[model samples]
Target: MQNTSHLLMIRPVKFSFNEQTAVNNAFQQNDTNNNVAEMAAREFDAFAQKLQANGVDVTIVEDTPEPYTPDSIFPNNWISFHEDGNIILYPMFAVNRRAERKPHVLKAIEKKFRIQNKIDLTALEANHQFLEGTGSMVLDRDHKIAYACLSPRTHMSALNNFAEKTGFTTVAFHANDRNGLPIYHTNVMMCVADQFVVVCMESITDENEKKLVRDAIHKTDKSIILISFHQMEHFAGNMLQVQNNRGEKLLIMSTQAYESLTADQIKILENYNRIIHSSLNTIETNGGGSARCMLAEVFLPVQQTQ
Candidate 1:
């Protein structure tokens, strides 16, 4: 299946801004007066409810409070589940973020699906190289392509290694924000779905690189929906397309991101799938991620019961 009806979400116990990530992630803002954790929890619940209402099979797990994983809500940054029953663990740039990858979480998931083999790339962190799971690379699953933007959190070596392991062709490029700073995560600038791709063309400043990315998307036979850098700031490009139990396609995004889109853009997207948005202001404002980041699609095969 191109899109999965099953998804995994991590409910935050101590959701707050990460100082380590804030250094390069321009989207994050630290506000002292607000109760970030409380507000984030409310937002997470609402978002999960929204997904459920849209027919998504959301598996929500609460993060443990002991380790204080502030950005635990964004589970897509640490682990990715595959259809072939492979669970890949990624190396994170932040020290605290590494704690987000816990064995207990995998244990919880194993109760529902079969996890045949595991790939641990955490050893690369010792070399000061990191690849923050789906945050660093957006997979075009059907076409077997991995789109990655080079940054501190996404290195060439790591991308190549991931491709070698997963049998995905790597399309690497450098993407920058409006201010010319490298975009911290590839998913922040682009999202690849089954039938469409939403991207910030302006972020790929190099003309040759821009053409290469555009050409690659064309080869995938997906309709390209381009968002400007301004819209990208609102997390417009961070949207994800997924399927529900009824086999209906739904494009998910934050309310902030939905409000940023043009009427024409919305019309184009609606042609392919219904658009769903939930208010995630607190999480997006403080954690530097949105609806897509909170969801880790579960593609593992269900275990057969005799």
Candidate 2:
């Protein structure tokens, strides 16, 4: 399925601005407020509640305080659950971020879902090669395509390896921000939902690469919702589409992202699904991630319960 009704969220305990990730993640701001952790925890609870209110299944696990993973709230970077009963663990770019992949977290999930296989790519960290799960590639699950904006965190070798293992075709390109710095993660610049994609076209300066990406999206039979650099800055492109228990599609985004959209863009997107946005200013500002990053879609098969 392109969208999952179930999700996995990690409630942050030591939530703060991650210095290790800020090196390439231009979106992170140095949150000076001493109550940063408290504010982030509240924002996380609200976001999860918003999803639950919409009938989406959410399994939230508290981050272990023993190892400080400041960016642990954004679990999409380290793990992605597949419908084929596979749980793929990705190689993280930041050393601190690596600790976010916790075995107990998966054990918590296993109580509700069955894991048939494990695709462990963390070994690539030994080679200093990385592909940070869905953050590195915006997957078109329905079309079996992985759209990627190659950067320091997303490498060709890892993408190829993933494709070889998962039967996905990778459409890779280079994308940069206003100052010509590489976009840290593909999810920041583009989001592939069930029926439409929100993307920052201006970021893909290479005309040929832009066309290639558009053509690839067209092949997947998805409408491309173009977002400007300004909107992208507000996390507009960082959206995800998920289904509720009633099978209604809901487009999830941060309030910052929703407010940034033009009326026309909003109309176009609502044509496909209902918009569900909540305030995530604190999380987005300090975490360098938005709603999409906070959610790790769980497509695993449900465990049989007697």
Instruction: Write down the worst ten-residue block by lDDT for model 1.
Output: 31-40
Tell me the tens digit of each residue's lDDT in model 2 across 1-306.
899899999999989999999999999999899999999999999999989999999999999997888999999999999999989999989999998888889999999999999999999999989999999999999989999999999999999999999999999999999999999999988999888888999999999999999999998888888998999999998999999999999999999999999999999998999999999999999989999999999999999989
Candidate 1 Cα misplacement greater than 4 A, ranges = none
Q: How well does candidate 2 score on lDDT at residue 226?
A: 92
Q: TM-score each candidate.
A: 0.98, 0.99
Per-residue lDDT of 102-138 in model 1, one digit per residue for the tens? Answer: 7778888998899999999989999988999999999
- Which clashing pairs does model 1 show? none
Please, what is the whole-model Cα lDDT of each candidate in the order they appear? 0.91, 0.94
Among all windows of 10 consecutive residues in model 2, the one with the lowest summed lDDT is 188-197
Candidate 2 — which residues are off by over 4 angstroms? Answer: none
